[model samples]
Target: MPRKRACDSCHEKKISCDGGSPRCDWCNHRNLDCTYHRASASSRKRPQPAEFSLQDEIEQRLERLESLLQGLRRTDRGDPSPPAEISDKLPSKSQPPSHGGIFYGSLYFAGCHLGDISSRNGIPIFSDEGRRWVQDRTGEAAALEGGQELSDIDLDFAQNKLSDLALLGGHNSAPPLPTKATAQRCLDIFRASTLQVVFPVVDLSTFQEIIDRAYEETTESTRAMVCVLSFVSFLSLLEPQKTAELLPDVEMYATKAQQLLLLTMAEPTIEGLQAALLLCLYLDFSGQLQAASMLHSLASRSLFMLGGHLKPKPPSGATPDDARLRHLRTLFWLCYFCDKHISLRTGQPHAIADDQCDLALCDDYTGLDFIDLKMDGPSLAQYLPKPLQPSDLGLTIIKSKVFSLLFTPSALKKSDTEILHTVRMLDEELERWRMSVPPSVRPSLSSVSDPADPSLQHEFGMLLIFVRFEYLYLLSAIHRACGRCQAWSVDGGVPNAVRSSLLLSVEASRSTLIYLKVASEMVHRESFWLVIFYPLWASVTLFCNIIYKPSARHAQSDVELVSAVPSLLKKLRARVPTPSEALHLQRLEAFIAELIHLANKAIYKHRPENPTAQDKE
Candidate 1:
């Protein structure tokens, strides 16, 4: 009798099947529905021995490759090999063994998490519980020393201000535009302020033309343009004394711009993209960082959809004087600038990747020749501030490189040696970039001792101050990797590499605070956002340093600097009109206060006379 054929299912699955009636033995064993097709004479031809051997070889090779891959995976996970005796045993049905590793649920960038430094190295005094214990002891010590109790203001503010600001959920209606005179006043203020210089997203003449046209006719494009203008006006009023009486109007304009931008979000245009970028700036300034970050992403995506990331090529036969294309390029660079800075500030990935676009500056920025237009008696250059230069974009490009090389996900995964090498290379590159800046606007590591040059102060002071703060901030960020990679000696001796990195990081933090302190007035007047993150970041670094080594020579001064944070934050809070600004400031003030208290307690315990006092407590 001819051999019975296998069922189709078993044959397709490449498994042995007994030719049973209605159902094969393999299908019956598995309780599967089985059907068999009638075998044709040609299909019944058996494979030659050589073919069978080849098929067996292929299967064996695949199995070996799979086993090798599994072994590699296990090695990557640091899993030890099982004993040969139990190698073929099935995994137990019982609960799997615990890996004994702690998993972190939240995102952490270099130097962002205090726990990373404190928890590692077994420093109990720097831990959260240790800080709480110190707080209790400090309260008792304060009571014994007749120290005044914390004021009711601080206590009440801490209790009430703990809630996060509501960044979303607002009225959807667009607020009415400001009166013509008020609008013009805002436009003038925006032009005069350093905001235009810093962002440089809009062309002054074009912006004026759009505003004039909006008053004449209300089209969709004009409406979006109005939104952009509203945001500029709102930012101009951030200086407390300049628009104290119109503080309420500041919110109105901000709301109007925000609502208008939302309306235009569904149909993104270049104008709408501009509005979104401006709104992002406003949100960041108001301490709505997450909202700002989301808006930034939206703007960045819109920019890509509009092909703003690529070099702008005018249409066929179009004149070389493509002002629109130039504007788009300007907007692209502004987005790039904001993307890098926001990523650093929030410890998040940047929206714009450097490799995706051209880094070269536009012809308008590189070309020095500008035909002076006579605006009545004043030239156009005198009438409106100059746009950003190649130097400005060059610094931004360097900043992009810093984020790419130092803080990126891949960078974070680099080995200790690789991280150290990359940090050194970036430091040298950053130093080179700094040296190339003109002396008039060059930033230094030391605090500014003399007043800025009156000639360049108005136009370039904000840029200079930002560069200084950013330099220190980047320095701290770069060297902080060393802290993560440093291995503690069994003998408790500090390694030279660790010492150098610690000093550099701490010095950068100190310089940031001192620079801000000296330039506080200018920073507050020109850009409130500049003061927001740098001071807090620096204060945290100082706090960590003091906690890590309370007996260090600068411990006392670090405490003093941390103590001064509340005052500085208060001054910043006074400049912004948002109620949430006060709440945000209060929370930071509380944190700084706690840090100062803990730092002071740690220092007291470390004193020679009080060496045994900590033990007694």
Candidate 2:
């Protein structure tokens, strides 16, 4: 008798089967899907590769059948089947983000989680007593307004996520807290190197006291303090060769610090905020982008919850320590600076809103020496302020406002008119900032030999370059946004609106490249990490134009602009200590090269002109 057809599943399993309609007996008995229907189809399509034997085809067919059966079995067992078209689309959740993706993802992750905390059972409470007092007063007001009061458990859980974690403690392999000597060493290193340069989140004297108190008696907060300093030590002090010796387990240290902070989260203090900031910066520099961003967001929320965002006026007839006030205020702005900086670059939403904050800009930081508090403190603006203020922190605050207004993700959702109006307002503010720069710190007035010339000098010039880099970056970002908004036309070809903005973007890009080229001469790894994304953004803009609109007004200029960026990146990369920087530059160079080749083909196809020879003639 002719062999009865069996399902693919039965055939692959080498089991006898009663070929039921649509399915076989063995598949049905096992509650598995039946592929016996495929047998007749497989027989009709007996075409095999000329090089493959019949056995090879049969083996391949069996293997494929087995795979299909396995998938069907999994589906029967409740596991979702993989997408049929997964080969065409990117595999989701199976691969890590690309390096560029990681960078931008880090920014997004940081922005989103800045204030994330569990609110179950009101377990986590605010760290600041002031916030608790405010909460009580608000609760009383609500009660007076006839609202029901929250239960104590609800209130405690509502406090913060840390309190929730503390209550729901689980064992984690966190590193041991440093001993007194170790903690003190880290504190001293942070105070000497990172404090003044990064922004002193807590006063040195106060942190010293915290450290001393830790030596006397250790607490969770003290342990967190030690961890924070340990991270800062890794960032600013520890020799690269000794990283293994010093930070044997960086992630463990970070986790321990986070846990300790959460455990004592109800009692928010300056030291806690300081520790959080250091840890965030360390995570950032260490390439733990997402973690850093999340931690930053958490610390920022804690600061806001603690009333750190609100500047408290000293009581009447009482002289408060303005130094302490200044330190706290500086910390708030530093947080704002970091949040806004990342948001602007990566097109993420900032953690805090503009209307939520009204604190003054960090005191004019110009001429502030490393050792003395004469020019760095809040009292300086009170006592020896300049008429045309030229301070790094002041510029950062101004840029933060611009970024909030224009560069955020929500900015794209606004109407064209609204975006243009905001851009104009930002442009006006930038111009105002330029005019406000004191001649001492201004790039124009200072002679080449002058000690203050940012271009010619090194020490002070580095800060000056930082300020300029930010200004140029924002300027380019604003115009670039305008270009994007105008780029699209109803006909799908390049429009007049886009063309003008594109040209403006190119000009701004050239100017930015020049600034980088100049800055690359004097500035090294220290400040490069802060503003590395600036040139990358500008280069990307130029590159996009070269590819999409190569036949537009400035094709030659665009090619030159794209070509120059890699050299500038190479210069910057030469001085950077991180291998990632070099890798990033190599990738950027490859991207630029690939795009330039495509752009050349596009230009040749569209215009069909020998413009190079014509220009040379």
Error of 1 at 214 (Å): 2.8
Candidate 1 local distance difference test against the native: 0.56
Off by over 4 Å in 1: 1-113, 116-175, 216-222, 225-229, 238-248, 313-321, 363-386, 389-391, 447-459, 489-494, 613-617
Quantify all predictions' global Cα lDDT against the true fold.
0.56, 0.48
Residue-level lDDT of model 2, residues 571-592, one tens digit each, is 6543333343333344445655
Deviation in angstroms for 179 in model 2?
Answer: 5.8
TM-score of each: 0.67, 0.59
Q: TM-score: which candidate is best?
A: 1
Model 2 ranges with Cα > 4 A deviation: 1-198, 220-224, 227-231, 234-259, 314-323, 362-391, 407-410, 443-456, 486-501, 526-528, 548-561, 564-593, 596-617
